[model samples]
Structures are given as structure tokens and as C-alpha cells.
Target chain A: MDSMMMGAMSKDMMSMPGMEMMDMSIMQACMDACSACEQACTVCSTQMMSCAPACMNCADMCNTMMRAMMRMQGMTPAAMMAMLDACIAMCQVAMDECMEHADHSEVCKMCAQACQACMDACMSMKNTMMSMS
Target chain B: MDSMMMGAMSKDMMSMPGMEMMDMSIMQACMDACSACEQACTVCSTQMMSCAPACMNCADMCNTMMRAMMRMQGMTPAAMMAMLDACIAMCQVAMDECMEHADHSEVCKMCAQACQACMDACMSMKNTMMSMS
Candidate 1:
């Protein structure tokens, strides 16, 4: 997330064959949202709510999605779209589960919001991919 | 990766609406592979190989992919495919980076192998999805 890291990532992304068309800003936002959501979900999962499993799962998905964006050279457009869909699906599930505990726990509420934001970011990425396609 | 956790995950994966179409055994194997690869990549990244950045990225992606499978209710088939594609992309990047150091570091060699195995498992899952489709 630091400038140096972003510089490294940006340089890498720019060099990818098809990714020359990508909007780095959008990708950066998505990765940032995912990192925040993963942190929130990880903390929320340890709270032992019924939502724990879903939160745990969401944490993992967000982290994976973030890393995938960072390593775009390995992907095709189809693959990127598939990943976005999956990340959105996982966030939706986690958000629904966490919302159930929102009134009882502040962490659950915060985590659910993070999941929602991550879902939105991923949706944006998906739309970007579609437009590019 | 304990039995209790596996039981928790298996029970959740089994109850999803259309996920009964999913093969939990194969899914389980993939998750286990991701977890192992993440651990290996994490340790390898801290070793400061030129491959460090890629290893760090792979570590994050494998963790996310593992967690996503643990939360299947969040996903549709399309989403699952996308996630697998992203994961495969990330793993390929990590494997290629680590392969450069394979002769100098046993850990890199092992991590590369794990990435290869994970890629194979993911490809198998993709093939299964295609067959199911």
C-alpha cells in the first residue's frame, strides 16, 4: 500500500501485455478495499458469532483477490472477470451473515460494512472488465 | 485444517442451494493445498529472494482462495470460476518467480512445487466445473 510498493506494482502492471488498457487507479482502490475488508473480517471472525465462518471465509477471499490484482500478468480477461465474480459472491455472503449480528456486536457491523464496500469495489472492477471486454 | 474446522467447513459447503452440484472432496483438497502453499510462500518471502514480492503476493492470494472455498454460500458458479482463475494467475506468477531461485534455496524449490501443485488442483477444479457446466 506504500508508494514504493505501489510503484513496484504499477511498473509490473504496465509491463503486462493486455493490462496496458487497465486503469491502475481502479485496481488500486479495489486492492485497498480488499485489504481493509480482510482485516475487518479477520477481527470479526474471532468474535465467535454465528457469522464467524462466513467472516473467516470473506477475509481469505478478499486477500486472494487483492493479490491477484497485484499479479495481473498471469491473468487473461476471462480469468479476471471470474475472480471478480467470485470475490463479490464471497463478500455478499459474508455481509449477509455479519449483518445478522450487527445489533449485537459493533465489530460485526463494521465488518459487514467493510464487506459491502469490498463488494462494491469488486463490482466496479467487474464493470471495468466488462467495458474493457 | 483440523478435523473440527473441516467438519465446520464441510457442513457449511453441503447446505448451499446449488452447491450440492459441487464435489466437496475435491474442494477440500484444493483448500488444503492453498493453505499449505500460503504457509510455504510466507516463509519463503521473508527470506528476501528476488522473488520476495511475488511470494508475498502469492501468499496473500492462496490464503484468500482457501478462505473463499470455505464460504461457498457466497458464490455462484461464475464467481467460483473467476476466483479459480485469479488464484491460478497469482500462483503462476509466484511459481515463475520462485523457480529462478530453486537451485539456491530449498524453500523456494518447495514453494515452487507447492504452487505447481496448487495450479494443478485449481486446473482440475476448473475442468470439473467445465464438465459440470
Candidate 2:
């Protein structure tokens, strides 16, 4: 997200219930990770491996997770938590699937790394929310 | 999806554990709905209303739901069910938000309609899964 949009989004989040303690830096990192993971997975999904489906699924999940963070005004805390969990689960599944082909495909390796990063970011967001609450 | 890609995806879905009973026509309609909903929401989000956030969130969810259907091989029945439920919830929220200003904005009216159509399609998919199972 651009600085101006992020500023606007941050302003919006302040009025949402249970989002007062959100760290913009943490959310920014997570959104960046999600964007990268989505890009990598979209590329990997064209590889025609059995992992392609998992890659496609993860790309969608990461995009959704990222957008949800940007649109916090539409979500409650519980809804955000559920979305983060779903994104984490998707990243885990995609990473495991991509790793199976990492030895043969460089794209798979990169995709797996992206998924791992996204998973970590989502976990951080979840933990941050828990601590703040 | 183009017919060529759809044909290939259909072939793949046949091998997934619980997707054999899927009706491709229903899947295609749902995909079309999702695609339309996503596009409409994307446009509607730029209107700077309180509904913008919900529209953004719905756009992401619809895109994810569409991709998940195209990549059924990545999903277990339980996971697919959960995703369908999430998509439905997102659509409901978005449609309600959009409808709030439907009388004033033509874009909101179209967006709400798209959301409603997407919800109906997703519900049909869920019902199909239940009946087949």
C-alpha cells in the first residue's frame, strides 16, 4: 500500500472496535508478505504440477487476507482472527505442497519461501492481536 | 474461464476425493458470478462510502471463492465447506452495505445485485455438495 492509502486505512482502523492496539508496522509487514506470496503462488500455479492447485488456492487466500487487513472497517475482531487462521492454514498447505517439488523446480522453492513468510506474518498478526487484547 | 482452461480444470477435479459429483455448469455459473461480483465491488469501493471497506473485502472473498472452485484438487470437503460459508458471509455483509445506498448510487445497486447473485450461486454449490454427499 502507498503511504497515503496506509494513512487513510490507519485512520479508519482507529474507529473500529478492538483495533485500537493494532501496530501499523505489523499489519504492513503482513500485507507485504501476503502480496509477495500471492504473486509467487500465481506464478507457481502455472507449472502444471499437482501442486498447482494448492498454489492457486494459496494465492487467493493471501490476496483475501491482505485485502481484509486493508478493509478492517468491515470486520470484527473474531472475523479477523478467523481470516488469519484460514490464511495460515492455506500458507501451510501450499508450502508443504510446493516443497515436494522444490528439488526439481526453482519456482516451487521460491513459492514455498513466500508461503513460509506469509505464514509467519499472519502468525505475528494473530499474536499481536492476542497480546493487545 | 476460457473453455480450454475450464476443460482442463474439469478433468482435474474429477480426480479429487469428493468433487466427482460436481456439476460443471453450476461451477461455471458460480465462477462467472464471482468474477462479476469482484469487478463490481472493485469499482464500487472507489466511491469513498463506509461501504467501500465492505466492498473491498467482498471483492477479495469472491475472487478467492472463484479460484478455489477452479482448484478443487487443493481442497478437502471440510475445507471447501468452510470456504463456501466464509464467501457467503462476506457476500451477505457486502450486499447489505451496498443496498443501504442502492437508492442513491447506480454503482451500489449493481454491486449489491452482483453480491446477491454470487451468494445465490455459492449457496447452490453448497447445496449441491450436500445433496451429493
Candidate 3:
């Protein structure tokens, strides 16, 4: 998301209890990571490898996690934490599955990297939430 | 998804410990509904209504829920149930929010209907899962 969208999200998030501490910089990085991960996973899924199912699952979770950040008004902190955990778990699974064939396929290698980035971003979000709370 | 893709998903799902009872027809309908809902919500979000955030959230959840069904190998029944519940909740929130301005906007009206349809499809999936379990 761009700065303008983040600005809008900031306003929306301010209304939610305990969401005031949400750092837009961290969220921006997280959203960007999620978006990139989703794209990589989407492309990797089309390859029809054994890891395709995991890639597809990770793509969807990353997209959902990104949008959830954009729509903070619709989420409770508990729900947000649950979703971040889900995203992190999905990214991990996708990364592991993708890494199995990474040496044979450059796309799988790129996907694994993207999944790692997303997992790291999500964990950052989780840590931020915990520290803020 | 095409029948071939569904067939592949069906085969993958059969390998899951307790997913043998999953019905392809219901899953197909639910995936269609999720896709439609995502499209409608994407359009609705651009309108910048107070409900835009909810619409975006619903769209993401629907997409995630759809892909989750396609990737049953990546999920436990418990995770699937949690995602379904989350999708249903997001859809309800979006539908309720969109209905408030439905009379003023045709897109919102259509989005609301799509959300309702997606919610119903998800519920049908839930019912099937419960019965099979």
C-alpha cells in the first residue's frame, strides 16, 4: 500500500481499542512483504509442483493478512494476533515445501525467500503488537 | 476452478486423515461464491464508503477461504473450521455495513448480495464438514 492508503488505515485503526500503538512503518513493511509473498506464491503455484498446494495456501493467507492490516476496524487485537500466527505458520510451511525443490527450480527458490520475508514481517508485526500491549 | 483442478484437489484431499467426506460439488459452489464475493468487494472498496474497509476485509477472507478449500493438505480440520468461521464473520460485517448504503449505491447492493451468498456457501461447507465429522 501507498502512503495515502496507509494514512487512511491509520485513521481507521485509531478507533480500535489497543490499536493506537500500531506502527505504520512496520505495518507498511509487513504489507509490502505480504504482497510480494502473495505474488511469488501465485506464480509458484502455477508451476504445479508438489509444493503448489502450500504455495496457494500461503498466497491466500498473505493476501488476507495484508488486507486485515488495512482494515483494522474490522479486527480485534485477538483476531489480529490469530491471523498473524496463521500467516506465519502458512509462510513457514510454504517455505519448507518450496525449499525441497528449490535447487531444481529458480521459482521455488524465489518463493521460499518470499515466504521467509513474509514470515519475518508477520513476526515483526506480532512482536510489535506484544510490545505495544 | 475447472473440473480437472477440482479432481486434483479431490485426490489431494483424499489423502488427508479425515477429509474423505468432503463433497466436490459443495466445494465448487463455495469457491465460486468466494470468487464472486472477492470481485464484488474489490469494486465496493474503491467507492470509499465507511464500509470500504469491511468490504476489503471480506474480500480477502473470501479469497483465503476459497484457496484453503483448494489446499486441504495444508490445513487441519480445526484450522479449516477456524478460517470458515472467520470468513463468515467478515462477510457478515461487510454485508451489514454495505446494506446501510445499499439504497444509495448499486455496487454496494451487489456487494452485499455477494457477501450474503458467500456466507451461505461457507455455511453449507461448515454443515457438510460437521455432518461428515
Candidate 4:
């Protein structure tokens, strides 16, 4: 996310209970990772491999996760945790599937990496929230 | 999305284990509902209410669910079931949140209705798959 958007979001988030204390930098990293994973998965899905469905699923989950962070007004910590868990699970599945073809398909290799990064980012966000509570 | 795309997907799905036996019309309805729900949720998110985050999350999940159905090559009945459950859960959350303001906010009312329709369509698709299995 851009600094301007982050500034806007930060202002809007002031009304949410715990959100005002959130580290925008960490949230921004998570969103960036989600966006990257979504793009990578979208490309990988077009490969027509057995992993395609999983990639597509991961892409959707990542996009949702990113958007949820952007719209903090609608989030409860519980719901946010659940969503992060789901995103991480989906990313793991996609990464596992993509890894099988990583040797031959560059797209799969990149996608697997993206999934790994996204999973890590989501976990980081989860940990941050856990500590906050 | 379109007849041409559906035709292409139908042809590509022929090799998937159980998908060949699936009903395209029901799948189409589910996809359409997801697409509509995603759009409605996206618009609703801009309202900046407490429901905005839920709406954003629902939009992403619905889009993901729709794409998963499209990429049958990547889905096992198990994964599909799990995804449907997640999407349904997210939609329910979004709907419940939106319903709180339905009396005054037309956008929330419409988003809630879209979430309900999407949930129904997804359930129908699940039932159809279960019967086939």
C-alpha cells in the first residue's frame, strides 16, 4: 500500500477499538505479500497442472485477506485471526502443490515462493495481533 | 462469466476425476452468485461502517470460491468442501453485520441479500456434488 493510502486508512482506523495501535508497517507488509501471492497464483492457475485449482483457491484467499486488512472497521480480532488462519492454510496447500512442478515450471516455482512469503507474512500479523491482546 | 468461457471450462474439466459428471448450469448459477456477491460487497465496503471489513472479506472469499469452481483441475471434493464452508462462513458474517444497518442503509441491505443468495447457490452446488458422489 502507498503511504497516502496508509495515512488515510490510519485516520479511518482511529475509531476501531484496538486498531489504532496496529503497526501500519507490519500490516502493509502483509498486504503486499498477499497481493504478490494473488498475482503469482493467478498466473500459476493458467498452467493447467494438477495444482491449478489449489493456486486459484490460494489467490482468492490472499486477496480476501489483503482486503480485510484494508477495511479494518469491519474486523474483530477473532474474525481477523480466523481469516489469517484460513489464508495461511490455503497458501500452504498451494505451495505444496506448486512445489511438485517447481523443477520444470518457472511459474510454479515463483508461485510457491510467493505462497511461502504470504504465509509467513500472515503468521507475522497473527503474532502481532496475539501480542496486542 | 460468459458462454464462451463456460464452454472452454466445460471442455477443460472433462479430465478431472468427478467434475465431468457435474452440472454446468448449477455451477454457472453458483459462479454468477459469487460474482454478484463480490461486487456488492466491494461497493458496500466503501461505506466505511463497522460492516466494511466483513464486506471486504466476503468479497474476496466469494471471488475465490467462484474461481475455484472454474479451475476444477485443482480441486478435490475435500478441498472444495472446505472452501465452500469458509466462503459460507464469511458470507454469513458479512450478512449478519450488514443486517444490523439494513433498516437505514440500502447498500447494506443489498449486500446482505447478495451474501444470502451466494450462500444458497454455494450450498446447492455442494448438494449437487454430494449426490453425484
Candidate 5:
């Protein structure tokens, strides 16, 4: 995220109850990861494999998960936890499918790595949320 | 969704664990609703209101929720519940924001209505899940 965007985000964050202490840098990293994973998964899903649906699903989940982080005030800890689990589960499914064709497809390989990274980032956020409570 | 897409979905649904009994028609309706709401929210977000971020987040969440339903095998019940909660929360945020602009913007009015309907649909799914459990 750019400085201008961060400024806009920070302005919003200040008004969110219990979110005053959030570290914007960490949130930015998570959003960037989610955006990259969504792009990778979208390109990979057009490959016409049996894994296409899973790829599509993963792409959507990553996009959603990223946006949810952006609108943190709307979230409860329970909702955040659930979203992380869904993102992880979807990423796992996508990674499994992409791995089957990883030998022949570069996109699938990149997508699998993206999914892994997204899953990790979500896990980090989930851990943070758990610890905060 | 069209018939061909529905056919593809049904074929895939059969392979998902514990999803053999899913009614495709209901699933199709939900997917269509999600897709429409995503589109509406996306357009609404471009209006540059204070609600733009929330609208954008809601749009992404609805897309993800729709896609997850399409890839049922990628989900566990816990993950599904989490996603539903996130979707509902996002929709609620978007609706509240959009309602503030509803009197002035037709797009916001439609988007708010879409958000409400999406929330209702997700709640229906959550209720179904709770009943099944």
C-alpha cells in the first residue's frame, strides 16, 4: 500500500473501536499477500484442469480474506477466526490440486506457492487475533 | 448459473465428502445471488463515499462465499461457519454504510438492498448448517 492509501486507512482505523493499536505495516503485508495469491490463482484456474474449481475458489477466498482485513471494524474475533480457517482450508485444497500438475505447469507451481504463503499469512493473523483475546 | 454450469457443479458436488444430498437448484440460486450482489457492490463502491471500503470488502466476501459453495470439498463445517459469519458481518457493515447514502444515490440504495439479501441468504445457509449438525 502507498503512503496516501496508508494515510486513508489510518484515518479510518483510528475510529474503529479497539483497533487503535493495530500496526498498519503488518496489515499491509497481509493485504499484499492476499492480492498476489488471488491473481496467481485466477490465472492458474483458466488452465482447464480438474483443479480449476478449487483454484477459482481459492482465488475468491484470498480476495475476500484480504478485503476483510481491510474492513476490520466489521469483524468479531469469531468471524475473523472463521474466515482464516476457510482461507486456509481453501488454500490447502488448491495447493493439493495444483501440486498434481506442478511438474508440467509453471502457473500451477506459482499458484501453489502463493496459496501456501496466503495460508501462512492468514495463520499469522489468526494467531494474532487469538493472542489479543 | 446456466444449465451447463449447473451440470458441471453437480458432477463435482457428488465427489465432495458428505455433499451427496445437496440440492443443486438451491445452490445455484445462492451462487446467482452472490454473483449479482458482488457486481452491485463493486459498482456501488466506485462512488467514492465513506462506504466505499466497506462496499469493496462486501463485494469480495460475497464472491468468495459464492465460490466456496461451488467447491464444497475444500470446506469443513467449521470453516463454512466462519465464512458465513464473515460474510454476514461484511454485509452488515456494507449495508450500514450504504444506507447512509441511500437517499442520494440509487446505486447505494440498490447495493444496500443487495447486501441485505446476501446477508439473509448467508443466514439461511448458516441456519441449515446448524440444523444439519
Candidate 6:
């Protein structure tokens, strides 16, 4: 997300209870990770391997998670937590599936790494939300 | 999604456990609804209303849901159920937000209707899955 858009999103979020104190840096990192993972998974899905379906699913989930963070007005802490959990689970599944083909395909290897990073970022966001509550 | 792609996806999904009995028509309807909802929400998000964030989130979720259905090889019944639940919840939130502005904005009114249709289609899919199980 760009600085101007972030500024706009932040301003919008300021009105939401429990959202005023959010760390923009953490959210930015998570969104970046999600975007990266989504791209990686989309590329990996083109390989048509057994892992392709999982990669496609992960890509979609990551994009959704990223957008949800950007659209905080549509979410409550509970909804955010649930979405994070779902994203994490989807990433884990994608990573595991991709790892099975990692040795045979470079794309799977890179996709798995992206999924790992996204899972970690989402977990961090979840932790931040937990502490705030 | 085109017929050729659907054919390919159908062939791939035939190998999944417990998916051989799946109804393609129901899945197709759900995917179509998701795609329509995603388009509507994306357009609504650009309107810069208070509902914009929710529309963005809903758009992402709908796209994800549609892709997941297309790539059924990556999904288990449990994962699909979870995803559908999340998508439905996001759509409901988006619809609620858009409904608040429906009287003022034709875009919001259309977006709300799209969300409602998407939600109903997803619920129908869930029902079909439950019956199959």
C-alpha cells in the first residue's frame, strides 16, 4: 500500500473502536507478505502439479486477507482473528503441498517460502490483535 | 470461467476423495455468483463511501471463494466449509454496509443485491455439500 492510501485507510480506521491504536507498520508488512504470497502461488498454480489447486486456494486466501486488513471498517477484532486463522491454515496447507514438489520444481520451492512468510506475517498480526485486546 | 476450463477443472476434481459425487451445476452457480459479487464489490469500493472498505474485503473473499471452487483439488471438505463460512460472513458485512447507503447510491444498492445473491449461492453450495456428505 502507498503512503497516501495508507493515510486514507488510517483515517477511515480511526473511527472504529480498538482500531485507533493499530501499528501501521505491522499491517503494511502483513499486506506486503500477502501480496507476495499471492503472486507466488498464482505462478506456482500454473505448473499444473498436484499442488496447483492448493496454490490457487492459497493465492486467493492471501489476497482476501490483505484486502481485509486494508478495509478495517468491514471487520471486528473477532472477524479479523478468524480471517487470520483461515489465512494461516490455507498457507500451511499450500506450503505443505508445495513442499512435496519443491525438489522437482523451483516454483514450488519459492511458493512454499512465500507461504511461510505470509503465515508468519498473519500470525504476527494475530498476536498484535491479541495483545491489544 | 469458460467451458473448456470447467471441463479441465471437472477432470481434476474427479480424483479428489468424496468429490466424485459433486454437482457441477451447483458449483457453477456458486462460482458465477461469486464472480458477479466480486465485480460489484470492486466497483462499489471505488466509490469511496464508508462501505468501500467492506466492499473491497468482500470482493477479495468472493474472488477467493470462486477460485477455490475452480481448484477443488487443493480443498478438503473441512477447508471448503471454513472458507465458505468466511466468505458468507464477509459478504453479509459488506451487504449490511452497502444497504445503509442504498437509498442514496445506486451502486451501493446493486452491490448489496450482489452480496445477497452471492451469500445465497454459497449457502446452496454448503447445503449440497452437506447432503453429499
Top candidate on TM-score is 6
Q: Roughly what TM-score does model 6 have, to 2 decimal places? A: 0.84
Sorted by TM-score, highest first, which candidate order results? Answer: 6, 2, 5, 4, 3, 1
All DockQ scores: 0.33, 0.40, 0.32, 0.37, 0.37, 0.53
Question: Compared with the true structure, what per-residue lDDT tens digits does model 4 show for residues A28-130?
Answer: 9999999999999999989899898788888877887888888766666776776787788788889999999999999999999999999999999999999
Better of 1 and 6 by TM-score: 6
Model 1 spans > 4 angstroms off? A1-28, A39-55, A64-85, A92-116, A123-133, B2-12, B129-133
Tell me the tens digit of each residue's lDDT in model 2 across A1-133.
6778888879888777788879988999999999999999999999999888888898888889897887778765665776787788788888989999999999999999999999999999999998988
lDDT string for model 3 (A14-129, tens) is 66778777787998999999999999999999998988988888888888888788778766566677678778778888898899999999999999999999989989998999
lDDT of 4 by residue, B40-114 (tens): 999998998888878888888888888878866666676677677777778888999999999999999999999
Model 2 CA deviation exceeding 4 Å by range: A1-12, A127-133, B1-12, B130-133
After superposing candidate 5, which stretches have Cα over 4 Å from the reference? A1-16, A68-82, A99-110, A130-133, B3-8, B11-17, B71-81, B99-110, B127-133
Per-residue lDDT over B1-75 for candidate 3, one digit per residue giving the tens place of the 0 to 100 score: 788888877887777888777787998999999999999999999998988888888888887888788777766
For each candidate, the alpha-carbon lDDT, in order, equals: 0.80, 0.86, 0.85, 0.86, 0.80, 0.88
Q: List the residue pairs that clash in candidate 6.
A: none
RMSD score of candidate 6 (Å): 2.9
Candidate number of the best lDDT: 6
Reproduced native contacts, each prediction:
0.46, 0.39, 0.38, 0.43, 0.44, 0.57
lDDT of 6 by residue, B41-129 (tens): 99999999999888888888898899888877787787788788888888888999999999999999999999999999999999989
* Model 6: docking quality category: medium
Q: Which residue runs does candidate 4 get wrong by more than 4 Å?
A: A2-15, A18-26, A42-53, A127-133, B1-14, B18-26, B42-53, B124-133
Candidate 1 lDDT at B57 equals 70
Model 1 chain A: which ten-residue window has the lowest total lDDT? A71-80
